[model samples]
Target: MTAREVTKADKAEPGSPEWLKLVTASKIPSILGISRFKSQFALWHEMAGNVPSEPISESRQDDFDYGHAVELAAAEYWRYKNDGWVISRGEVQYTDDALEFGNAATIDGRASRGAWRRIVEIKTARDLEEWGDDGSGEVPADYAAQVIWQQLITGWHEPANIVLWPQYGKPKIYSIEYDAQIAASILTLVREWNASLASGIPPELDDSITTYETVRRLHPEIDGREVQLDAALAHDYLTAVTDDKEITKRLRGLKTRVLDAMGNAQTAVVVDLKIATRSPARGDAIALRSNTKADPATIEGISA
Candidate 1:
């Protein structure tokens, strides 16, 4: 990719009208079905302009704010640890010069060493369990996809590094090597997604909670009505519910057995691996309650 073939969109705030029109790096994980927070169906609907963008809850907004606040700190740490590396923290967005399929990226930071340039993505995590050892290239699939998408948009195939700030430790870096095959596959997927948008057909639904919530939001009315159901779907639902009850009962029995073996111990272990740890519920424990509503239904009927 050449500079002449790449166009920059200045100051395109996320969720703005201009940003919504383009498939940014952050959306790649959703499209690839690896995003922990978003489902492909939700992304498809939003990109198709069929529904309003999902609102950010207060807790989610706090997460974003924390990430934005420490972005510079993460970048600075990266520079401090890696000698001779210069980092640029700028709000720059990029797309193809031809604007093909409207793919875009707003990189968190850019790094350069002499003539070699690399994309630097900053992330904050509550824990590093989901992340791999530093420089292992074993980051979460969603985050890895985000970096690859950034590289694709920036036309920089040089390996990009993810600078992560964990809750309790100094930052760590994960390096992702560029794979042309993966980039091509992602590009094809992006093109197909755009084609689906143009065709006015949303992506098929998955069994993700995000997808289920999106469906619920799309149809929020609880009207006094009854509708026919497909036989197969009804039978499957019944079977799933029955299995869920049996599984829950078995799980409880197993937990009781494990606790009996542990007997006043706080930690459960097997050989060298830690299986589970029991800790007293504190801070916000009283407030942390399930939001799931009871299913108001009989075998013959259903309601929200």
Candidate 2:
């Protein structure tokens, strides 16, 4: 069944095999490719309010393998619990797929008769080297954003723990906290993105969209230049451009101008360009942006 079809069933109901089938199948499209599927999966997991599971694939069974590892880890965790372990393999419903709005909670076991605690999210890596040395693991920024989203949806007040199980090493756990403001912003962005995708239009890339390499390559003068633009800067830029047409045209023009300037020069030249913005505080700011040096004569000609 298609993703839309599979997502039509109620996902919160327990003891319903159809719900399980639907939940499992809805993730098929996301698991088949490595594109932005991972980000989408993270978002879905957060929305569902359950520990994120790997997408099931027949050829590799990575999801099942990781799930089994988590089962072992959970078992190990229970050994420390003063109360007897009340763990079940797959028993909780985190969300209702039929309805767009829902909480993130486990569909599985309880630690005790009166306490229904959710299992922490599990992520498996091939080795310890795969994780960052800081012990936080190399969780993607987007994935962290999703985790926050999950917390908001589930209304869980406590910080969430993410377990990272390396294939050849002992498991490492990272704690993450939810940010309500960030989650709200992300939800707004996701809604806009989904609407654009549904309308068969891809999202446009703006100045904030250009990666470090792309920016350096396109504007050689910016090469080795250290300038940090935080989320606030990016969010302001994105939100300012309400018209897609205007954004596309402006970016295309800017790209053409930068390329033309770079191509004509043979030596490195620093150019001071005026960046126009709608912000009241910074009205039109003129920043001295540098580029590679081209021949002085050639540069003069372009400037002339």
Instruction: Pick the lDDT winner.
Output: 1
What alpha-carbon RMSD in Å does predicted model 1 have with respect to the real structure? 8.5
The candidate that wins on TM-score is: 1
lDDT of each: 0.75, 0.44
Assess candidate 1 and give its TM-score to the true structure: 0.81
lDDT of 2 by residue, 92-174 (tens): 33442433432233422322334434335555654233355234556645445545544544455356555666555566666
Candidate 2 TM-score, C-alpha based: 0.43
**Model 2: how far residue 3 lies from native, Å:** 22
Q: What is the lDDT of residue 165 in candidate 1?
A: 86
- The weakest ten consecutive residues by lDDT in model 1 span 286-295
